[model samples]
Target: MRLYRMRLYRIALWVTVPMALPLLAAPAGLTAVRAARDTAPEGAPSVWRPGVTAQPVDAGRPFPALGAASMALRRMVPRPAIVSRAQWRADETKRDSHAHYAGGVRAVFIHHTDTPNGYDCADVPRTLRNLYTGQTRDRSWGDLGYNFLVDKCGTVYEGRAGGADRAVVGSHTLGFNQGTTGIAAIGTFGPGTPVPAAMEHAIAALAAWKLGLSGVDPTGKVRLTSTNGKSRYARGTSAEFDAISGHRDGFATNCPGEALIARLPAIRGLAAEIQGRYARAVPFPRLAATPGNTHRG
Candidate 1:
């Protein structure tokens, strides 16, 4: 019999069918299943949904997600309190996949630390240090994946090994790390958990600076390829995404959570404003047309 899977606007299938064949099944059943699987269209989400558009993914670097406007890869916003690896007192005992490098920044992904949010502002250093220890020692990542982290009081801590202004590739967003930066909001923000206003502004500032580096508008959207089939998107999928997006947009997790995700539009707008301010501060050279040449030189 033909099968179909249904999807809601913001929801996934309630159950996922196992792809592996059952060993206890009889030969006749196995043969029928194999024939059905082989007959399904390529890149189908599953045998049950042969016609639904399955999200694509890729194992290689994802394509750059950019907006309508293009700009030079110049740093525009000032680097905020980017705590270095040494500053975070990271434990270098863990091993991980080698660092990946990106040519320039294109987007900023928002995330949540999934940790407590009640620490004093002055204790941010310790919090960051602990985070580094956990990610490196427990998770076995070479470095903390987030490019920067924002605390409830609006304090921003630099993450990973590279300099804050550099296009440091991160492991934060599964399948879409290249050409993007990750900013983790240090708290589990669900119902009743108020996202801090200062933290939101800090995130906006960071997004403004990072996206501005690649001439991207925070309020715009860009295309990115998915490298991990396990993510919300399938491998080889080229999806257009907001320049400022939550981790959930790229992966199958509740990172950046509901509260932070709710504030993304405002954050994106504020980032655009910050970018505009920076652009105005540095005026571009006016090209004048010479008498002998029709082209402005």
Candidate 2:
């Protein structure tokens, strides 16, 4: 990761935060997933459809007290494993090698592929390749627009050519791509649609690590300037946005859909908690003087 000189201190503090689950494994169902063949299958015949009502995760739980030293400690969480372009078997020859790296990441924007949600988790690699063709061939983009893409089952796929460790600029969000990460959820999430709990968990985890790198608060605000008039903000206009924002925030589109957008508040708090910003360093309710509950000190 080529970090800008300005974030040195923040990056230093980012690694020292205390984690409740230091060695936590990848999200449920991710460990068992393996990439499909490099080429798209003739037809997907095995889609494991899920229930309509989404089960909630820890993000919905109440947060602990704000530790006085939390800022100094920084928000450090384990980096989620990202299946690289090669791992997903992207057609390398089709993409142009133009890369744009940013100084640091200030925010992360959420998006949806606008495709059907009843996809087999096993077909993710093929889906990624198809998405690559849509953008590179149909949309004429040099490469995939999203910096990262998460599936319904919580598998994280690395999009774009640049390494996930670096601040690679993407063509997502029209005007807010610079200094921000575009994380597209790999299915359409419209009204009445259920967003899987595992998907939310994975997104929150990834956002925590990415924004934590630059010490950006997931629940806070960031100012960004627009470069394209196609966006809601005119070119050169500066706008303030949440550190974790929806795709519609900067553009005139119904993307990321209503269902996923509704979960943004919980996602922000969860990311904050993961970074230790909203987690407790001291035990709650204070230990009693009783022998069973007393502290050694």
TM-score to native of every candidate shown:
0.67, 0.69
For lDDT, the strongest prediction is 2
Evaluate model 1: give its TM-score: 0.67
After superposing candidate 2, which stretches have Cα over 4 Å from the reference? 1-74, 279-297
Evaluated against the true structure, the overall lDDT of model 1 is: 0.65
In Å, residue 130's CA in model 2 sits off its true spot by 0.4
Q: After best superposition, candidate 2 residue 243: deviation in angstroms?
A: 0.4
Worst 10 residues of 2 by lDDT: 288-297
Please give, for residues 13-104, the per-residue lDDT of candidate 2 as tens digits: 77787557554443454323222211111111122122211111111222323453323234566898777787778889886564655556
Q: How accurate is candidate 2 locally (lDDT)?
A: 0.72
Clashes of 2: 0
